[model samples]
Target chain A: MWDYSETVKEHFYNPKNAGAVAEANAVGDVGSISCGDALRLTLKVDADTEIILDAGFQTFGCGSAIASSSALTEMVKGKTLDQALEISNQDIADFLDGLPPEKMHCSVMGREALQAAVADYRGEEWVDDHEEGALVCKCFAIDDVMIRDTIKANNLTTVEEVTNYTKAGGGCSSCHEGIENILAEELAARGETFTPGAVGKKEGFVNLAEKEAAPAKLTGVKRILKIQEILEGLRPALQADGGDVELMDVEGKNIYVKLVGACSGCQMAAMTLGGVQQKMIEELGEFVKVIPESERPVEIAGA
Target chain B: MADIYLDNNATTMCDPEVVAAVQPYFSEQFGNPSSLHNFGNKVGFAIKKARKSIQTILGAEHDSEIIFTSCGSESDSTAILSALKAQPERKEIITTVVEHPAVLTLCEFLETEGYTVHYLKVDNKGRLDLDEYASLLTDQVAVVSVMWANNETGTIFPVEQMAEMADAKGVMFHTDAVQAVGKIPMNLADSKIHMLSLSGHKLHAPKGVGVLYLRRGVRFRPLLRGGHQERGRRAGTENTIGIVGLGKACDLALEHMEYENTEVAKLRDRLQEGILAAVPHSFVTGDPDNRLPNTCNIAFEYIEGEAILLLMNKQGIAASSGSACTSGSLEPSHVMKAMGIPYTAAHGTVRFSLSRYTTPEEIERVIEAVPPIVEQLRKLSPYWGDGGPIENPEEAFAPVYA
Candidate 1:
């Protein structure tokens, strides 16, 4: 189903360096069977030259994983340990022409295995275990540090892209918020604004265009329900701030809300209303104004 | 050499007879069945015949009970949602965890909409716990939707008995019979299932056509509402070509049912036995004695499924896998996971579904092709060592972070 390149197919069908290097002194293992993909890279390194004389791999995963492992083995041979360490996941993907975005994690596995193997040869402590970083995706055992690093390396802007590259947020998707936070932080570090729903345009999986095109045309009851749902989502945030909002009425693009609890007449009520309006527009994919119940026109207010 | 397709559970090649039967409706009988003219009447009559064919296959009392829809998903959605609407007071639903996404996803959405859903679990053999099913049926339960057979494992559920249980509780019972319809025999007239869904494509008909068999007296609400089509039970113009194709597929299926159980099953057993004999550490992954004759799911320890599938693809063999890699998910199939299959075997699960058209020679090809692929992948698997699959595989392959 994945649109794998012919080169990838070729590498998978006739994997160049499968199995372990017979007289290998350095070895590295990344991923696990439970993760759905694992790779063990064995390298025969020349002690004097610090060069990899031979490289071989055994992978337990998909076609792309096998192909990536084969490609990684071929790419590392005859290269210095430093040079082999320079091969990024993208480089492995490039060697195979390209891997589907969903299978990009396969290349990442290859890169990690290479790094582990190099570290093993150098006798440096390599940590592929989960103890080093804060775990973000409990389902896939992906961590925040790994997510941030992957985002930086791959220029990933969306949670879906991060998942493709790192297998985070791909399981139950409960960690998408964590991944988004990490993405936002990385993007902010790069001086880029994190745009929500941008994944809809890039992946085209969600129909943001349809929602954005006709949010105003949603029928009365449906629009009311949508607004109520959005308000419910915002309720916890408002309540956390010792304030609350109630939907008073919805007329056209105007949303009438009553700021209750500690927010009724606060100095930041205007800012709060502005924030609420912004969230509504983002979530509803429509332009709308949030009006305080006190500001409601006399005629409609009485009615 | 031609490609040998063993992925019938995913989809099937359209039979020649089905294609021929569908051809005329695309051109000569292109008139809308709703129009008031001879052309419309001819198409309408053809649709009636198609409905009757489905009725006969399902052994339903009336042809009107067969409501044609777009696909199996639509039929499933219609039945579940309609049951809820008809019994608005009942806010509970009971279903199995191993249902196709068509049912599972809908039930999940319903959960968010304030409906209490009890997901029944399956055993290691993929068999439902009847005692649990019996206990889950309560007065507040609106519907119990369970699949007749699992798509991944082809493990047939005792739906008739389950339906009888639900029916006694005044609850609607629906079965997604998409996989079970053509391969297994069922007489709905003697059953208590209020609704059943079957996709045309699964039975060798064209896609975009399915049937929702609503028993004569079951209360109903339409999922799609517009034109007074499908006698107001369903909306939109009829899929005439697809309906005719489905009708013919049903006729052909009725004729080949015996062969599917006997000859096709023989090929399936041969393939299963051959692959198991050839490949060590491989085992079947379903209720062996109670599965569809056309389906066999095997798991090769220490190797991943996509690798095996790709290697098989090189040899012009087609199959399906429950591997997380193949599913585009990070976890193996929910079916395998629910069955508590060890990760060592779950990641390597492959499903080979045959049809009545399958031959022993093709089965022989698969048998010969699969062993080497498994052997090849196992050799590449880190868990597979010099002797064979490593002992303590579960501890070696357990979730590292967990």
Candidate 2:
């Protein structure tokens, strides 16, 4: 559970200006359901002064998110559009006596919504550099620009903290390597290379996330064709060992294989299974699991 | 303030009787179970008696099979790594995609160590594909560890059947029954489960105490190497008080098992049904018939789970979620993701787990409080439409010139 500050809890419990502004000139909605947090900021601005006469927010997120939205509305109520644009996510966190690092992304949502709302007030588009940035975290629709900005703002060196701050690399973590690369690039620009310390090296997250995130929807003839190609590559070595491996059937994404001759009873057969599966994943975009026929796990005598 | 707690799956409050049972150990009975004196002997005896109670509940062949550990994660690690060490020749593991981090994270680490892990997928209702499971069990597989019941959805796995299949194939079978031991019945004596892990806190005992039930005569390797404690199966002096509390908790759970499955289950169904009837665009997750009696995981579209939970908290209602925002991870639950739950619904999924202590009044309070909360959050949601959630959350990436 999050160690939410008292101020955050207070604002979340009794959020002020939580409803949408009716007949509002400016409306800004940012984030997506996929990200698990979204905010819509509605501002009733004085047209001549460009002052935010009133601010309202409707947020779909956690406590930190509601608190951030509530705090953001309070922060921008009396500020001009230009002044409102200067309110960073950090300012929202500060207002709430600081949010848990993991909930910083909630504050980030508030800032983005505010920016979008301001852009709407000016009758202009959110012209964020995110438009040009590559999509690094597809699970959350987070772009490279979002990652870079959060990293620079928080002086973040670890992927975990980056996820906390920006929600990039938070889902399906297949983008961990991508996040690591961006973190390094951002740090390098600041003349600060991440000192790969205990925490950084301990998780070794890149391989696992990348591997687990393998495409999960390959099927039909395409799946069979890919599995067959992988089997062909693995055939020669098995043949040399007086053993042969063949793809027998494809059920959904599961590839049924039969090991003929020596390979059927070989001690290193598990290694072969791993090899076949790994090769299939590497070549076929990782949607198939190789299930060998005519094999049962080693039986043990019950005590 | 009237508080209602329905997140028992996350952690249960210690039963007063169990707390009383452990109180003495913190003060007067502070002697080490490893000490030679009379005081120590008394503590050791209590620990032994607690083990017997748990053994009785689990229906294990012997009390000796129970080895106390610090937490469920330690027990899981001990069971898995020990199997790998015992069968160094077999380098593969078969598990489910919906396993808790205790198993999944360890399996991920095992992958880096050159171990092959087959994560069996679950269907939309969170039921494991047993045919896929059976196919993955091979001579090269070291062990198959699946959860007795999924914590997020309370969906029970066919552990008894799965264990038998693994046992027939000469593979070790382990089950992380942390969420199942107290919520469901078990008769390990008639089953083929080689090892099982249970957490103290999940069953109304205090945290920091867990159990690893290793079938007697199974190949074993100690995870922690230190003083000859837990018969050398685990190192470090025993957490005597916690063990006693756990034993007492098991006894309490056994005593209340009927109540848990009857009245508490009725309350859960009522809450689930009430919310579903009142709240629009909501549906339950998991196989309804096969789920644990005290658990109901429901997904409310458009509104984020964290936001709903926060509002509930304001109303003094405590619950949990499989939502990405609540997990401190940008991605929603791995369980939901594995089940192929749509993004709009998955983001709003909340888990309400009842306990034997839950009351009908509390259930009524939650039912009354939830509908309005969901309706309120949905009003603010950008995705909520006249019918349900809007499909496209955002437009595809496009350049925005300043």
Candidate 3:
């Protein structure tokens, strides 16, 4: 449900190097104090040849952490120190098919620890966190300028949308609410009106994301006969109630709608959601289960 | 989606029989249980019958001991508050470390209000350290309330012996039997415990109703003050539907009481064994013995519990996890932590609790679904390879061929 990249699902369902090694040459441990992922890796190296015969990992973390650990153990074994250094975080992520940009950091940790162990083996003071730092991923990495640009380009729609599109503050979350403040600052600089919801969970995160991502395209709908037409026609009515309805993609009978502004906090939102919107949507010939778009699947962070 | 109900420890399905019992109150026979007229008398008879039925279950000495409450939380608050009220001058109470939040947080609140509360520690197996508990008990202690069994781990505490200790000193004893009632054999008359709380929802009864057992002559004050209901011991309009459902649930439980321990235990043990055998790095948490007949807490080392629950949910298997969200702190289960379970295993704790409804087929589905998920998560771990990414999955899979 967490918009996991199919790659994460694959790795999670088939993690490698699960058990403890019979004997390990070097064991490395690393984790973040903020995120609750703590990892302990074991290595079994042939003493005479100084080549890793077998390696295993034991992690106390999430899917990405476990898969990254398992994937890395298989990547580096039997390789010489120099060859192992060539294996980057990107390479580790790619090996597991690919990690969600938010979860790329888990793979990065695997890369760093792997490189660090190799460094320790070669008697070099190298840390792996720095290996993939140069790669400027506009979507995931923390390069302030890229973030500012992404937020600016996405428009002053909603803070929640910026998170979905750009993966800002997605990794090692503790910065998401802070990311919203940063968005507000950027909007203020541009002389754009940016007011966050006064209270309650975001009126609707899924629609907020859909709205931001499909800004230009949402207006120019090719098919006018579907539920989208009802959403477009009913927008003015919802606005009159001090609320706005945003369409979250309709896949058959399940129509997701977000209640913005005063409508979100209104006790009548549930009835309006089911009775008004659901009935109208059904009249448009769809079995309407008007789920609150905010409550729908918008990956906040790892559970 | 298949929304199978399996988290009995969390809450159970409202039994159809219990639902039928309360249907009359919701529809035709609706009336207050305390009116002077025939309608009131009829409802009052229903309330009394429900109380007597629960009394028989607890083997209570007095039917007056069973007081219907709003829920388990209210029952807990009433018990602790009564202990404090009895000895307003004294400011000490004692409880175990793993008591449910209903009891634990109330003790915390009491401690904040100048009440000296002693928390009895538990060992690695979640067994109560009675010596540590005894050391804290003194004449100044007004009461001692420990849970009969923990909610997350299903580790049964030695409350009966602890009750005897409290009784010797004229101190009151209470137990939050929220998770233990149907699973364990609890008889208040035979035991030294004076007060016990059981939420209807924990059994097959509906929510909004609970019972607090007060031994005869135990001094206490009403928590809710209003018109006289519950003999003025608790003063609120009786939750008529809830009372009826709870009464019926107690009757069904009594009928099925003989096989509850053995049948539920067998299913739980099957689940525990199958999970351990299937998953490579996973092992069961809590003591193998001295555990609940229907609960197994297993730590699938290196993964988050919430993620596992989400995954299990996708597979249509309902279960519980002792994750960071459950604890107010970002840390894992406090019970698991008190047992000295390392953070590695602690984060991955999942509780597969069974009931009379559980079957071996469900256990088989769990075993089939879990291992591959664990294996998959491990493949993505940063700890897997120290030097770089893993390349040779075939060689890794070679052992399977062998």
lDDT tens digits, residue span A159-225, model 1: 7567656767655677776777787789999999887683432222133233346544777898899
lDDT assessment of candidate 3:
0.72
- The DockQ figures for the candidates are 0.29, 0.23, 0.08
Residues A1-303, candidate 2: write the lDDT tens digits. 678999998887778897777778888877655666677788999989998999888777777888898999999998999988898888888999987756777787788888888888787877543232556776556777778877888677778667655766655578887788787778889898865454443222333334456566665777678678778989999999999998888776567789988988776565577567657756876545677875424468893
Stretches > 4 Å off in candidate 1: A129-303, B394-402
For residues B1-402, write the lDDT of model 1, one tens digit per residue. 788999999999899989988888888989998988998989998888988899988989889899999999999999999999999999999999999999999999899689999999999999999999898888999999999999999999999999998998888999999999989988999999999999999989999999999999999999988999999989898989899999999999999989999999988999999999988888999899999999999998888888888788878899999998886777889999999998879999999999987888899888888887887777777788885977776565432222
Ranking by TM-score: 1, 2, 3
> Which number leads on DockQ?
1
TM-score head-to-head 1 vs 2, winner:
1
Where is the poorest 10-residue window by lDDT in model 3 chain B? B393-402
Model 3: chain B TM-score vs. truth? 0.93
lDDT of each: 0.86, 0.83, 0.72
Off by over 4 Å in 2: A1-7, A44-54, A77-80, A121-124, A130-303, B385-402
Highest TM-score model number = 1
Instruction: Show the lowest summed lDDT stretch of 10 residues, model 1 chain B.
Output: B393-402
- Between the candidate structures 1 and 3, which one is better when assessed by DockQ? 1
